[model samples]
Target: MNIDQAISARHSTREYTTQAVDEEVIVRLIGAATLAPSAMNLQPWRFTVIRDQALLDRISREAKACLLETLAPGAQSERFHALLDDEHFQIFYHAPVLILISAEAPGQSVVEDCALAAQNLMLSACAEGLGTCWIGFAQRYLNTPQGKQALNLPQTWVPVAPIIVGHPKTEPAPVAHQAPQIRWIG
Candidate 1:
């Protein structure tokens, strides 16, 4: 698919099939991620791909627990708890691969660069006939020391986002929103 088609078709997929994504496909996704534009071409992003079921489960549990401990008692936290039930946690949409995006410390634009990389990965997944979900919620815990140790991430790398990838069980229709109101000065 072309870039426009991928942009139009890409959507967050919360459900996925049981099939596994091949290593080559993941490599292609990473390759696409690398093509994203970066500030000063710093390219400060790194990825950790998790495929082992036991490890995935451990990360999920730790993530949820960490959120529960830290998040303020608010509607958002309540909703998170409701959505991330035991069943949802068990399968994680049954996606075979979880890609953790991280950024190197030092640059002020590191977060933005990481976000760009994530968008590229998601768009590339769509082009490859795969589904992806950008999981920012996972960062709440994945940034912690326990999460760092769980993923064996380096101390200098800060976790930014996690993208879940697999064959989608259901495709979400595009969501509509009002166009942005901008003030343009020529």
Candidate 2:
């Protein structure tokens, strides 16, 4: 698919098929992510691809535990609860590939760079006939000691977000646009 088609078709895929994405496909996805613009051209992002089911389950459990502890018993907590109970939440609908995006600290623009890279990866995945979902809830638990050890992430690197990748089971609905809230000054 072309860039426009990819952008138009791209959406947050919550459900995916169980097929494993090929290693070559993952390489292409990362290549696309690397093309994202960064502050000072400093590519300050690293990705850890998780394919082991045991590790994925552990990460999910740790993340849910941390969420339960940190968030109040309200809407946020309810959402966490639902995520914990979701069959596809941690496993990405049993997709064999989970890419964890991380950034090294001591830099001011790391997070922004990582976000840009993530957007690129998602769009590229859609173009490649793959589905992806950006997961932000994993960061909280990933910062903890147990969570850190579970993923074997370096101390300098912090988990920023995760993307679940696989063949999409269903097509995403198009998003509606809202009125522009911009002011132009000449």
Best by TM-score: 1
CA deviation > 4 Å runs, candidate 1: 84-91
* Model 2 CA deviation exceeding 4 Å by range: 82-91
Per-candidate TM-scores read 0.92, 0.89
What tens-digit string does per-residue lDDT give for candidate 2 at 1-186? 888998888888877777889999999999999999989997888988998978887777677767767777888778767777665566345667888888876488887898899999999999888888887677777767777788898887877768888888888777897989999999
Model 1 weakest 10-residue run by lDDT: 85-94
Residue 54: error of model 2 in Å? 1.9
RMSD of every prediction: 1.8, 2.1
Which digits, one per residue and each the tens of the lDDT, describe model 1 over residues 81-134?
A: 776655556435557899988997747888899899999999999998899987
lDDT of 1: 0.85
